[model samples]
Each structure stands twice: as structure tokens, then as C-alpha cells.
Target: MTSLVKVLNENTIYNSEKLSNFIKYLEEKYIIKDEVIFFNQLVNFSQNNSIPLHGWFKYREGYSHTLVREMITRFTIDTKKEFIVDPFCGAGTTLVEAAVNNLDSMGVDVNPMSVAVTNAKTNSYSKADIEEVKLLIEEIPSIDLDQTEIIDYEDIQQYFSEDNFRALLAIKEFVNNISKPSVKELFFSGFLSIIEDSSDRKRDGNGLKKSLSKVTSVIDFYCDKMKLLMADISESSFCNIGKGYFGSATQLDKYVHEFSEEINKKPGLIVFSPPYANSFDYFESYKMELRMGDFIPRLGVKGLSDLRRLAIRSFVSAAKDPIEVDEIIDLMAIEIEEAIPLKETYTGKKDSRTRKVPQMIRGYFHDMGKVLEKCGKVLESGHKCCIVVDQSSYLGKIVPTDLFLAYLGEQVGFNVKEIIICRKAKTSGQQLQKYPYLAESLRESIVVLEKK
Candidate 1:
């Protein structure tokens, strides 16, 4: 994929009328002159690495807990006024942050692994809980990786020495046997958190790639991680003990319907970063934990692809025929389709990426449209939906996701309230080829919309 992006680079931005018209439409329609605010660091997860309970599991796609907190404070919403909601609550960063601030929260995700991880982070735990987990760990009997029927990933064996792999398996088996659900989840989370060390995979911008492997002490690392998690739980100023559900964000009403009487009393303040139009499969990124921890029963490569298809259509794997639409989604699809031919006129032949990216863009907006419409059904009329999204450059054309989604929000009865420019990303060497024509830096946009 990296090589393909390089192939698409003509070093000269080809002029396309459709691209200009789309940008012009965005500027005129949604981006008001003084409303584009800048917040460089807050749009990312760097700060969350140091945060207490929120830092336990490293979900590559999550934004900062600080971003959620600041957005909440900016709204000046006390739980007394409204409960926080994060529909695409990857790893519960927003809900966990809300818990720290003594606010009520409700979060749900399409990914079960994500939901389980979120539940682990958001649930209350005591010193007794930590000690209980420690006792279970202490009770684990030594196992021979050579004899166990449980298998590690086919190629993952190369990343870990046999001894290290054996130790990890023993811990996984031990944690799996624990009878207590919440404590088991907490301990399992700590176990998953340290899985990356046993593999060469390191997170790189929404995806994981083979990187330098680290020398690790498997059992000791899990023990240390459990201690950190227990410490965070001990120190929490949990006010509402937010609940997390293992379900799709698009089914917000169904998830909340069980507690509708209580939920409807407070309007919802939602803050989440949905998957981007770029095709970075989360299942692929966390394969180490997914496979080794047995999150799914034998979810190999094919199973991972199947799961990807079920995710919001941000990645190519999730692409389906674009549904007929007359609004911003259709316009973006038209712009993408019209812009690609221009690349061919100047660059001899268009790269295949140019051909496929438009469909992905179309499908992404289509899925996002569903998500927004569902949010409208459940959110209170005056509350805001805060979203963090990055502009993606696909096939030598930049996709203005933030701007387009804001317009789409308006279509779903949302007021385009504020556009926060978190950061203007520095051009990648590959992206520089499309320069003079494409904007130099991609943007991380925080689009805030109020339900009308």
C-alpha cells in the first residue's frame, strides 16, 4: 500500500474542477469564517497514554481522554443536566474520563472486544478485587506450550521465543478459568495489554505494522500491568459507574430502551471518533490480542475480514455499492469519481487506488449517514455530537471528511455548530507529490453539531 501511494504521486497536483467545486461548496455552506477553531494536540491519543485507567488497553484508533474531558467541560454539562453518551466508544475513553469527573456515562460499540475492554476500564474494582486476581494468577499451574492444544497465531510464533509464548499462554489459560466475570475481565484486560510486547507489531497511524521486537518478561509484565490497573481503580472518583454495552452505535435506541425511563430524563452529550474513510482494520491491528486471547473462536484471517465487513464502511474491506443519495454523500462521490480521471490525463495511467478509493468514500459516507440518523433519534434536541475525524488523502485526492460530515449532520436535523481544527498534519513524502494542487497538510477536524 505504501508503494502504491508512492506510484500515484505525480509531484504535481492535477487541477480538477470537481475537487475545487466540492471544497468551494464546503467553505460556503458549512465552514463559517470565524468558526474554524484550532486545537493541535487535543485531537490525538498521546495524552491518554499517561492517563490512569484509560491507558490500560492500547486501542490504536482512540483519541485522547483529555479531548473528551475538554469537550465535556466546553459544553459545561454536569451529569445533573445530562448523561454523557459515546456510541462509537472505542475502549471507553470518553466514558472513563466522565467517570473520573463524577459524571454519568453510557457507551456502546460494535466490537465485542472493544466493549469488553471498555467494561473492564469503566467498572468499579477494589483492593480486594486486585488481590483476588493476584491469587488466581498465583494459582496458575506451569504449562508446556509444546503440549497445550491451544495454538498461537501461525506466524506469531516467530515474534516470541518459545519460552515467552509459553508463559503468555499459561497466563491466558489461568485468566480464562477465573469464575468472577468483572474480575476476570479486568485481569484479562491486563493480560491483553501486554500482548504487543510478545509481537513485533506496533501501532502506526490507525494500523499496526511489524516493528522492532522488545525483550519482555511475560508473567512479570502482566503482574505489573494488573497492579497499575488495580491502582487506577483504587484511585477513581467514580460518580456514576458508567455502563458499556457490546452492540453497534447505530442501535442506540435499542440499547438505551431498557433504561429509557432513566435515560430520557437527561439529554445526551456524545463524543466519539468513528472509523475513518481510510481502510485500517482494527481487527488486523490487534491480531495479537484477538487471536492469542481467543476473543473470537478461531477468527483467523478470513474471520477478521468478515468482522471488518460488519464495521462502519470506513475501510475498503467494508465497502458495498453506494446507496443512492442526493445530499453531501452523493456530491462527494461525484467529486471523487470526476477527480480521478484528471489524474489519468496528466499521470499517464491512474493507479488502482484512485479507482477503488471513491467507492470507499461513498460507502463510508453512507455508513456515517446511518450512524448520524440513529444518533438523532436518541439524542436530546439541544445536545451536541462531538466528533474527531482526520482528512484522508486517497489516490492523490484529499477527502474533506470533517466538512462533508458536518453538512451531512445538518441533513439529519443537526445544526452545524463548530469546526475545531485540531492540527494541520504535515505532508507525508507520498502526499507531497499531490501538493501544489492538494492542501499541504491534512487536517484533524473536531466537528461539533447540535441536534435541532
Candidate 2:
């Protein structure tokens, strides 16, 4: 067997030749399949279902389930371990797969809403729970559309007719009355999934935000979204699972430590698609959901600024150290420097926010490192971890996220085994002129690491 130490060094960018050789060796030894075939299978499965975990969250900028599954398969093969950990688990794709495979798994994210969605999707529950929630929703008094005036809310009002909004609010009110955390979370998952579609924001055919309208009503939008959410939840297997929690990954160690010996031995697997190195602000993109769910106060004139502060603080709190902040800032600075030349090459004016990419990148990695460190401590030795990440470009400079994270994983005591380059679909509205190098390729790489 190749030594863990050797594998760790092989993941570095400087060791590209050795890394390629090692990956080929693993493919032959472990019967690893081709990337193209693997991607095709996932796409087909998603098309058949029309509701991939990727599609369910409708995070236009998120990672695909095909990529997530590939990472899980690769890690399980290499370590021959069933348990997994995704410290930055979002929307519970990893947790749901883990549950389906009957692997004990653990997932964590700083976003409370993400935790709610993931938890709702992964927990085991009874058919009775769904029936009961359904009955409860039916019993709630019908919402009077004329009285509610849901369109008055600023964030998401224009997407739905008044009747749909009232129906959605009624469901929310009914779910609120139910004291069961598992039931409430399951319902909430459905509620959140519909937010974008019910809003005034123009959606691409796949239900992602294109542009937000000023006249949008947040309340009405949330109401309509809740109805769609309810329908989606009713269709999923998650209605039968256990409840997940709302907490930061940085606090996972403490939470896990409190579990009794018997529970601790259950061993957990985590699969997640964390924020990318590029400057996609998940907090802002998803702020409407939070606002509608009452997770955060309204985003008024001061809303964006207030939310930004909250986001930065939340991320920083989840990080392992003060220095991580600086490291992420440095990485973002590198991205900014690269993007500047691209600005001249591309016709449109660059978003001023592009300049702040460095700070966001810094904060993202810093928190991710801390979460990984915590995961290392909580996961049992010999367990496997699979992170699906992409290499990003800012300006024209490439951010070798897979290699950089592999290095960070080693520093936190995990052993980097392989980095698999898989070709996947490109992001929406991604102009080839804007990303000349990416025109012929949509490369999504998976970094497989094992807990020592």
C-alpha cells in the first residue's frame, strides 16, 4: 500500500506528475471508473428525477449531486470505510446519501437555514409523521388574501398571485403550531425550496435567481414558496427520517463530545459542497429565504449592510483562528489581481463587489479550515472524507482550490490521498469570452482525504 505521507505530498501542485501517476495507479487497483461516464450517469439520474439534491436547493452556483456521489464512492473505495464527515455540509446531500447507504454520518454548516434543510432531509421518521403534518396543514384556517396584503413585504412579493401567497402562509402557520422539531424541519425544508420560484426574481428555467425586482413582496413570495415546499417534501423520502440540528461546524466537536459512548460509536459520514473561492455571496443570495423564514430581521435600506456584518461575524466565529482570516484575504487578493486583466478583456464593466472577493475568499477558507480541524478531532481514525470542489479563476488567475485545500487538510492532520479531475457542466450565464480558458471545459475536481 502507498504510505499516507507519500499520498499527502502527491496532492501538491508542484507534484502534478506524481499525482497523475498515483491517480492512475489507484484507478487500476480500485477499479475506479471513467469521469465522463460517471458524470453522464448523474446527469441522467437528475433528469429522470427532475429534483436532484442540486436541483432541490436551487443554488445555481452550488455543486452537483453527481460530483458529490463520485467523491463518496472514491473515498469509500480508498479507505474501505463506511463512515464520513462533511464539516461544511449544505442542504444535506451528503447526509441523505449516507442515510440511504446506511452509513453513520455527520454534517455541519454555519448557516442555520442549511442545517435545517439538511437535518430535515436526513433524519429517519415514520409515515405517520407525514400524515399527521398533512392533516395539521389541512386543519389550519384558510388565509384571507385580501386581509394579508403579502405583497407589502419588500423582498419577494411579485412572483405569486394573492391566493397562492395566502395558501403558503396558512401552511407556515400550521407548521408553526406543531411542536415536533422533526416535523417542523421537514416542513421547513419544503418551504425554503420554493422561495426563489415564488419570488419576483427572474429565474432561469432551473429555478435560480437571474434578477430581483424592486416591487417584489417578501411575504407573498415566501407564502407561495411554502406551498411548493410542502408539495416537494411530500414527494421525498426525507419525510421518514430523523431531525437534524441548527449549529456551526466549529461547534461540532463540543456537540459530539457530549454524546454517550454508545452513540459516539455509530460513526457518521459528511458530504457537503461548501462555498467556492470565488466571490459568490451565499448569505446575500439566500438572504430572502432567511428573511421570509424569520431567521433574520428584514433587509431594509440597512438590510444588506447589516446582513453582511452578520455573515462576516458568523463565518469568523466558525473559523479556527484569527490568522485564517488573513490567509483568506491574501487568497482573495490574488484572485482580484487576476480579475483586473480580465476586466479589460471582457466588454462589460466589472462589478465593484469583485474587488471584495479577497475578503470573502479569506473568510470562507478560514472558516473551512477550522471546520475541518474540528472534524478531524470528532471523526474516528481510518474514516474517509470526500470534498467536491472546483478550481476557480478570478481575472485570469486560477485558484487551485483542490490543491490548496489538500494542503490545508494535511496541516490539520488528515492525509490527502487523491485529487480527481472530473469534467462537469459549467455555471449558468458563464460567458466563454469572460472565461476563455473554461470554454472547452467544465472541470470539477474531487479531493479525497482520509482521517488518520
Candidate 3:
């Protein structure tokens, strides 16, 4: 498998056909493009950037509302789809949008911040509720952040100015005084919405960047957030139909059994966009928000270590053991390491944050395979699962993630219904810089599978 390949700015290195062979194997099930959908059908941040409550907080990898709506219409019969479960429901697009259309839905995620945001987004709000929040805003008092413990980490402190920190404290302290659970969650979400404005920490898709530029007041940002939130809520119906849980996606079926009423049937459609295998960790991205809410350390989700443990291997690995997956996947990972050699890929490169690309790649499909098995247990016969995902790559080795998941679905008693080409994904400049030999970007597709 060893063959000499030219590496940019580095010595001529050994490359393996492992990646090529892996893609070739996947070609057995990988359906070439049949047709193209509109740009809005693709899962992206742009489509969601201007949308109401959907735009509240940026879960950078979260898909747009139109994707969910389109999926719901296509899979359901006359809007009679009884249940939808999203194991990796970031921002609760599936659950929130489902409730808007008056459908039953459940959402799950390992990240506490994402779960809380989704829970608040899907919560039913009314005119009275909005008024209650506004009144609380006026009544709430600002506390001296010097005396209060809003954020305690030094790494996080690098992102906040003293004034920004104090202003954020006032808003969070206000949220703490609210007694209503629903209103509390809503206000807490509103508080989170303004974090980007309060801090110089600009959240790019893959990483956080520190900016020295001046930002707006926390109160002003929160006020703007509330106005848009109230507008979104005003048009939103109080369905009481959607529910979200703070749990791991790997155990989604367990949550289904524990939370479901006797009358609630198995899900008719299991639709979600799991985070890509790219090195984007939600827990790291929202550290400021999570620290403010006290959802980390001893209080929330688990600790930072445990959150990474529960999360799909999307980014850098901790000292934890590698997750067990299919032998083929493991072998491919081994071959990837042998072929490109992770260390060699970044010999002269400045950004060398990919020591564990093999594991993240293996761990992603590994956890997703388990997710499919768990989801398979709860889906009715003939029910469909629609997974929106983009292709994942490491070094020059691109993994056909959607196709691999489709094959894994077949192994767990589901037939590949079809793979729909949504749109060609926009390659990041970082990706281009990272893998110079790779010629093209991959496609983002919806892999449709049905229980046999």
C-alpha cells in the first residue's frame, strides 16, 4: 500500500491507496448524483443566519429550518407522521419545526448547551409569557461581577473585557431570579444569544477567534434578542408537542422508552444532521455560555472530560480509550495512518491540530453506527430515517460519510431507500490549505434509509 507521493513543502512521502480503496469499496453503495436541489435545501449556516429564533444562537454546524420542513413534507403522509426523533438535534430544528407544524418530536444531544437551547427553542410561548419576561427584565437588578462568580476560568477570561463580563453578569443574575421554568429557560437562552456581542471571542465555524474590536452592551444585545424572540414567539403556536432531553445520542432509544407515553408509537421518521467528523467540538465552542450557565465542572452534563467522552469523536481526542467500531472502519483508519501518516501531513504546516484525525474519523461512523442500531430498535417497519451529512476528510483521505452510514444502516436491518444530492459543499480555505493534493470538495447529501 506504500507509494511515494508529493507533499506540499515537505519531502516526497509515502502515500497509501487505502483512502482510494476505501472510497472504491464505498462505491458499491455510493450512488452518483441524480439531480440537484436548491441552495436552501443544503444544510448550512447562511440559510439559518437571518431566520428568527433559529438564528438566536449560532450552533455553527446546525442546519436550516427549510431542510427540516422539506424532509417532513417528503417523508410524512398528509402531515400524519406520528413521531420524529433527532438523536443529534443541534438547535432543535427538527423538534422545533415539528412542533410548529403540530407534530410530535423528540430531540437528544450530548452537549448540555445545545440541549438547553433546543429545549427553550421548542418550548411553547404566549403573549403573557413574553410580557412576563419583559417585566422580569425591568425588575431584575445588576450585580457587581467582581463579587459574583459568573465565569471562573482564565482561558475563558481571555475572551471577555471587564465591562463585557460585568454586563453579562447582570443579565445572567436576572435570569437566575426568574421562578418560572419555561421563562427561565427562555431568558437563559436570550442571555446566551448575546454572548457573541459581549465577548471579543468570535465563533467561527471551526474555532473561536479573539477580536480586540469594540462590541455592543450586553443589555442592548439582550434587548435586541428579546425583541426578535418575542416576534418569533408571537407567530409560533403553543403546541406542547415537542420535547428535548439532555442525554447522549448513542442512547436515544433508551430515552424514547423512558420518556414515551403508552400511546406514543415508534417514530415514523428519525431525521437529524449529526455533527460532521470535522474537528469542531460544540463544548469547546460554547465554553463561555456553558460556564455562565454553570453546566460544566461538577454541575452540568458531566465534566469537560465526560462531555468529550459522550460526544461523537468529532475533534481532538482526550486520554480516553478509542471507541470500538467495525473492523473495516478500523482497518481503513489504520490504512489512513499508514498511507498519509498524520505527523507527515503537517511537517511544514502551521496548523497541526490533526494528530487524531484517524480516531475522529473512526469514532464518528462508529458512534453513528451504534446510533443507527438504537434508532433501528424504535423505528416501525417501513419507517424512514433521513440523515443530513457532509463528507469528512483527513489529510488527503476523504471519507464518504453518508455512503458509509448508509451501508451501516443496511447491516442493522434497513434498506437504502435513496441518497439525494442536496448541493456541493463549500470547501473552507483552511481545508484547501490543509490538503493541497485533494482536488475537489465533497457533496452534502441526505441518506434515506427504511426498515426492511
Candidate 4:
């Protein structure tokens, strides 16, 4: 049986058997350890709902605070460096956890909503800010906005009932007039959190879809969300602990350098989950929220397209951009490219998206390699970098994302300590019909690396 390493090095076509053998080979070579019980609910977002500040927003993409706490506990043992860094700070879970532990941290993301969420959850909330939020809630009923100014984003309008849509606009107007920056952020955060719930459509898979969910009144929902935010703020000891920047992880060094200069400390541990190689575009998933919050409007008219280009090239839709990177994993890219069938291969129906997988895979790794290189530069010596990522399957071809990232980490001055297989993941139902063999092979893993 051809090994994955040999196939990758030879730049040969990877068949299902070769791919299967390669996974087994990697498992043995890396000393794979299954620790599913250890990570049970820690890797999920459902556990976050009852946890003070974490529960303020329902971010389905984020990992739990317990998971971050576990990483800090394991890595922060004897390390002299005292700061945490989350390059892909989705929902600010890592930053919040760092702050909860009284450690200074910084986070960066391409999405403005992500930065906004991180800033809201991690920023210091003063007593006056809390008072201002209370006043806004009291004035919620009397506040009504003139509809002439608000740009009619039809996409967002379709997701809500007429009354609910009007309520959303009213709150957006109300949030804009708030004087205090911190208070404004807090209210804005609360408003964004309720967007999915208020809309008739829910964020499912790659984008929003019509759902059975209903909100009696958008205003009531926002009020309830604010109350939750207020309670978390009143009880939490968050004091400007983490800085969230609206930027990319490939520029990890720049973000870290700015923060390091102020605090005189490099990141003790780097914990992040980049977008998976799966063709899931986060911009599409949060389109309503992004438009409603005016995060995209800052990018001009072609806001969504521009933002997608800025994000890591993990999705197929982003494959249209020119592929450019410092290091190209030529062999693996070749194999992935070959495995994706040509347009002629489809017998019945053809997915045009399938043709772009090869380029997306190449771009994803090249983009990730740059991020790893920057991670290697910014992370403290001998400190660990923990990555949460899921492997993907296209047709019958399995993309071992965890292993590839580990390989990339090694190339960029890091030692792979171990790969903890969190759980065996199944491929999409559609893919499973065509590729049953991939079901048992794919997994979600934590790639732990120490900067050498």
C-alpha cells in the first residue's frame, strides 16, 4: 500500500485506498490518541449558554470556555509568557477565557462582526455604561425611527416580518445615537446577537434558510438580550483584558507586535481555529447580521465580495482570486487537484462547485502556511499553539486537515507534540451516499505544537 507521505512526495494521484492507508500510517506515525471523553462538551457551544458573558451571544461556530481553560491549564504550567492570542477570534471565546483567568490577550479576525463581538465581550464595562444600557431599554418603547435614511437592504428585509423588520430598524437607529463608545458596543452586540432569532430564517450550514423559528416581537427579544448582557456585565470582572482587532491571521506578527510593545510580552500560547477546507463561507452565514450592523458597508458597495477575498481561502467561492502564497505544498495540492473529477466525469448531475475544490485546497494550505509561519514568529519559545480543525472529504477523497497543518507547523519552526483526535466526524449526507469509505476515516482534531 502506498503511504500518504510517499504519495504526497511523489505528487501522485490519491485513490480511496491510498488515502485510507495514509490516514492509518499517520495515526501510527504520530502516536494518535483518542481523548473523546476528555473533550466531551468542552468543544461545543451549547455549554456556553449558561456561562455568564459567554451566553450573551449565541455563536454556533465557537468552542466553549472550558476548552480554552483546558488549553491554558495544560500549556501555562511553567511558561514565563503571560499572554494568549487567538488569530481567528470567533465570538471571542478564547479572549474571554484568557481574561477570566486574569491574563492579558489579543485577538484578530477578518470579519468586523467578529471583532465587534470580541470587543463587546472582552472590553471593560463601567458602572456608567451599565446605567446607560438601562436607560436605553426604558426608552425602547417610545423610540421610533424615520425610515427614510436607513438603506433598504432587501436581503435582510426578507428574513423578518414587516413589524419585526421595523423593530430591528428602530433598535439600529437607537444604538447609533448612543454617546458612550463602550455602551454603544454593548448595545450593538446585543442587537446583533438577536438578528438570527428575530429573522424567519436561521443560519444553517453555509447560509441562512427559512426555518420554523419565530420571535413574538423583535423589540422584546432585544430587551431580553440586553438584560442578559447587563447581568453578565454586572457580575463579570472583565477589565479591558483582551484587545480584538479587525484584521487577518496571516498578519499575526503585526497584531502581536503592536500589543507586545504596549505590554512587553509575547503570546504565551496561540489558540485558534482557521476556516476549515470545507466550502463554508462565514460571510454568507452571517450576511444578515453583517448588513444590519453596517460592518460590510465600510468596505463600499462590493462589501461582501471584498470581505470574502480578505478571508482565508478555505471555501470554493473564494477560489476565483489569484492564488498567491509564500510556500506551496505542491505534492498534496497535486493529489487533491487530481482527485476532483473533471466536469466530464459527472454522469447525471454536475456540481460546478466541485471543479474549484483543487484551487481552494491549494489556497487554503498556502494561506494556512503563512499563518503558521507568523504564528511561529509571534509565539514565545517553547510555548504551545493549539488549533481546532476538522478534516474534510470531497467525493471519496479525504482531506486530512489536521495532519497537513501539523506538517505546515513543522516547516515553520514548531515541533508537533501530539494530535488529539477529538471525535470521528461523518461526511455530508450527500457525500456519504457516494463515498461511504470516508465515513470512518475523517475526524476533528486538536493539533498541539510548541515553538522551537
Which candidate number maximizes TM-score?
4
| Error of model 1, residue 417, in angstroms | 1.5
lDDT of 2 by residue, 1-452 (tens): 23223433443322234434443444343322226555666656663125533345664544555566666665563223334555566676666665555555566565667777777666555678767666655544353435444544555544445545555555555557678877777667767776665555654432235554442554444444445545655555542222244556667676555432424443344455556665555566676677667777665646545444433232222223334443433644454645555665675675655555555556666666876787678767766566677656555344456666666677787887776655543544554465454434334566666788
- Please report the TM-score between candidate 3 and the true structure: 0.86
> Model 4, which residues run further than 4 Å from truth?
1-13, 16-26, 41-46, 77-81, 145-155, 298-301, 321-329, 342-346
Off-target runs (Cα >4 Å) in candidate 2 are 1-34, 47-63, 70-74, 77-83, 137-167, 203-243, 258-262, 266-269, 301-332, 338-351, 424-431, 440-442
Clashing pairs in 1: none
lDDT of 4 by residue, 1-452 (tens): 22334434443326445454555566566745677766875656448778988887777778768877888888773234568899999889899988888888999998889789889988887788788878888887666645624466765667778777788888988898998898899999999988888888988888778984488877778888888888888888675469899888989999999998887776788998788998888888788888899877632348788888789998887766667642334444555566555524755556677778878888898899999999999876888999988888776666788988887888899998998877766578877776555555577788999999
Candidate that scores best on lDDT: 4
lDDT of each: 0.71, 0.55, 0.72, 0.79
TM-score of each: 0.86, 0.71, 0.86, 0.89
Between candidates 1 and 2, which one is better according to TM-score?
1
Tens digits of per-residue lDDT for model 1, 1-452: 12112322434322554545555566556643221343444444357878788788878778877777788888857556577778788888988888888887888876777787888888777667767866765654343345544354555666566767778877877787788888998888888888887666676755577775574667677777777877787777364757788767667777655444665546468788998777666776776676676766554567566567667877655565646654555555666677777768878885675577667777788778888887788777888898888877755566678888887888899999877766554445665664534453466768899999
Q: Which scores better on TM-score, 1 or 4?
A: 4
Off by over 4 Å in 3: 1-22, 28-33, 37-46, 77-81, 140-155, 298-302, 318-324, 341-352, 428-441
Clash count, one per candidate: 0, 25, 0, 0
Clashing pairs in 3: none
RMSD (CA, Å), each prediction? 5.0, 7.4, 5.0, 3.9
Q: At residue 352, give the lDDT of candidate 1.
A: 70
Worst 10 residues of 3 by lDDT: 1-10
lDDT string, candidate 3, 266-341, tens digits: 5778899987877777777777777767777542445576778888777766323767878767765675566554
